[model samples]
Target: MTMPEQITPTGDMTVQTENLCAIFGGCAKCPGHAKAIDCGLVHLNPDALVFCIHGCHQLRVREKA
Candidate 1:
């Protein structure tokens, strides 16, 4: 995978502005899949990072306090 040029930190999370197609297993076989990929934002949380913009997949993160 190609690394993003810049990764900005947003509060307790960090984000990289790049195309995450490879990680998300390409675009979904749907009408709006293209649009969703184009407008999607790759978010990295404490536990996992997801490349979903249309809520296709649900990612849960549990932080141990």
Candidate 2:
């Protein structure tokens, strides 16, 4: 028997493949700063929140700490 081919992450979440966008808040080094930046690869979680894969240090969609 042959096993099914595994799907690679491709640096993106399967759930939020469509309409993906990063929602950044605050500076990467500082939390006090609030800002938003557009990300190339963004994935949404169960709650439908966007997250950045690059780890820009900005506020991600969900708990990406």
Candidate 3:
């Protein structure tokens, strides 16, 4: 699937926020970062902590060092 544009007429910024997660150096380093869909979402009353289906499928909590 093609990467969704950050700005859309829909006015949803979820995708843009998701990209930030990738830039955190975690998903950004992942093989699917470039093609990630429904990734990290940040907004009040969010539908879910992880909106990305692919990300959820492969979700793993990082253990504190």
Candidate 4:
């Protein structure tokens, strides 16, 4: 699946792709993250969080340490 352009809450436009999960990072915290990646609906943005457009709609965000 192709990535979709979406407007983020901060008003910045972000792009996502099927390979995003691998590019940014895998969503190990949530099961849905992996499912979305497998389904090719979730994409990742370096500046934003990873989320699924279909299936689980899981949001993946890196927690600051």
Clashes of each: 0, 3, 1, 0
**What is candidate 1's CA lDDT for residue 50?**
27
Judge candidate 4 at residue 57 and give its lDDT: 48
lDDT of 1 at 21: 49
Q: What lDDT is obtained when candidate 3 is compared to the true structure?
A: 0.37
On a 0 to 1 TM-score scale, where does candidate 2 land against the true structure?
A: 0.17
lDDT string for model 3 (1-65, tens) is 23344323224433322433343345444444322233332243234222223463365889999
Q: What lDDT tens digits, residue by residue, belong to model 2 across residues 1-65?
A: 12112222345443222221222333353332221222223223323323334334345577668
Name the candidate, 3 or 4, with the larger TM-score value: 4
TM-score winner between candidates 1 and 2: 1
Could you say which candidate leads in lDDT? 4
For all predicted structures, in order, the TM-scores are 0.25, 0.17, 0.20, 0.21
Residue 64, candidate 3: alpha-carbon lDDT: 100
By lDDT, rank the candidates, best first: 4, 1, 3, 2
Give me the displacement of residue 4 in model 3, in angstroms: 12
Give per-residue CA lDDT, model 1, range 1-65, as digits (tens). Answer: 34343335444453222244443455564232222224333334332332334344445789999
Among these predicted structures, which one has the highest TM-score?
1
